[model samples]
Target: MAADDERGRGVLTAADRAYLRGDSEYGSVQAERNARARIRDRIYDALRDFELLVEGLDDRDLDLVFEKRVGEDDGTEAFDALVSTLAFLYRGVGRTDLDFETVLREGVNLAEASEDRGATVDFDVTYHALDADHLLSKLDDDESLSLTEIAYLYESADVTPDELAAYFEDARAPDIEDGRVQSNVTDY
Candidate 1:
């Protein structure tokens, strides 16, 4: 009897053509494809729940607040601004035991790393602080976010409100030679 021509069907489909060309056996190809499909299905299922949870949240619930110091004479003013932004974001939502300074340091490190990789990072910091109890209660009841997920959300909020507002405004404004906002002087 002629061997069944399984080409164009099952694991012998073009999807596994490359692997098969590399001398992979038919059984192995089938196993790999099945495993990949299973993994993909699991991820889709997980994302469905995540999407539902996010859909339930109000826009205001996501807002956060941060402080910005302007016109400081200190040389470290810029550095302080960045740290304060990060600290404010991590406050309340972040681990209570973790030192605020540590979170700030990590934010600086992450920002530097992002810059080194030639990636642009844009963040918006909320004016509202994180409510740990509220977050925990939601998580407990909804199971939408894991502890790790919640922690990261709080961690990434490390930007100041003023800086965030400025960043957005700068993004929308037209480019100029000095990159400073144009102001008009009027005599009273």
Candidate 2:
């Protein structure tokens, strides 16, 4: 929709559909498949916009759930949409057998895709707990940290909320102002 270029069959607005041909005429962009994708993109964008602005007038509508926490007042509400989204994305992106939490938080590395048939890719992702000491130790001052230690750190850690908040206790930190970053991180 941005006025950036005059190429690529332009936008396929619904109003312009009347001029569309019944016979499959390939576009210069590529072939019939490429043209079909472009047209589909146009239709989906229009419908998505319409739903977002016009279809949510009723707050109690069950079909319009967008967040995983909805209907959880009693704590047993299902997270179907969340589960489906994660499953579909992992499958499409060549990942299977991965848990939703892992995909949501750490994500997968796709570069090693050809390593194994079971895992579309091969990856040596290291999970770790991180603290300021761990990160500062990755630096190269004579106080320069050991590369092995840094590797070991990332291979197994996450920074606890309290530890990260303590960063600003030093008065000379980037996320200063009484550890505001720590406060926001805690909120998350």
Candidate 3:
């Protein structure tokens, strides 16, 4: 809940962090890059197996289903991140012979309308990108919080990440001159 609690934390291992942090004078970053590249390749391979189901679908069927799942699940921040990323991918799929742009345009319209009205999506557990793993660990330490409870919290909360980001949009990490992260989570 506090800003100091979340920054500089990650779900990644120290080696991975260091590699992404890019002090590769000794080729550590390169190694990390290679590791990520391998993972990407593997993901591609896996998708190839499911290509028939996953590929060449538009928002009407594919993207709509994805959004429906996200909307149904509510404010699952991390999973939402994944879904958001996937939605972005879906957005990139251009019109095809079988699918037109109408689905994507309509989907975007729906999302914009929902967000404009401040429609709440509940999350049972949620975290900002920089602090997700650390936040999860912290939540784990709470006697009252289980993975299920945390997940519930993520799913139950009505707050959207866009709202969270907007609350802190004007404040940079380096600009904090006082206690806590230099962002107001409560601001309109």
* Winner by TM-score between candidate 3 and candidate 2: 3
Question: Tens-digit lDDT track for model 2 on 1-188?
Answer: 33222323435643234326342354565666676777778756754664454444444444354333355422212433344445555564454566544544433333122233233334454666655565655432324323333333333346443443343234233433332332222211
| Candidate 3 residue-wise lDDT, 47-129, digit = tens | 46544544345547755666674455535443545754555455444323423244445545555563464333432425344
Backbone clash count, each prediction separately: 6, 14, 17
Where in model 2 is the C-alpha error above 4 Å?
Answer: 1-20, 27-29, 55-188
Task: Please give, for residues 1-188, the per-residue lDDT of candidate 1 as tens digits.
Answer: 11223334532344444444563543687887885676557545654654454456443443321222233423244444455454545664364776555555655565465346433435454454555555545544654543233433333445323332232224322222222221210110
How well does candidate 3 score on lDDT at residue 172?
40
If scored against the real structure, what TM-score would every candidate get? 0.18, 0.19, 0.26
Rank the candidate models, highest TM-score first: 3, 2, 1
Q: Which of the numbered candidates is closest to the native, going by highest lDDT? A: 3
Measured over all alpha carbons after superposition, the RMSD of each candidate to the real structure, in angstroms, is: 23.1, 22.0, 16.4
Q: Which ten residues in a row are the worst by lDDT in model 2?
A: 179-188
Better of 1 and 2 by lDDT: 1
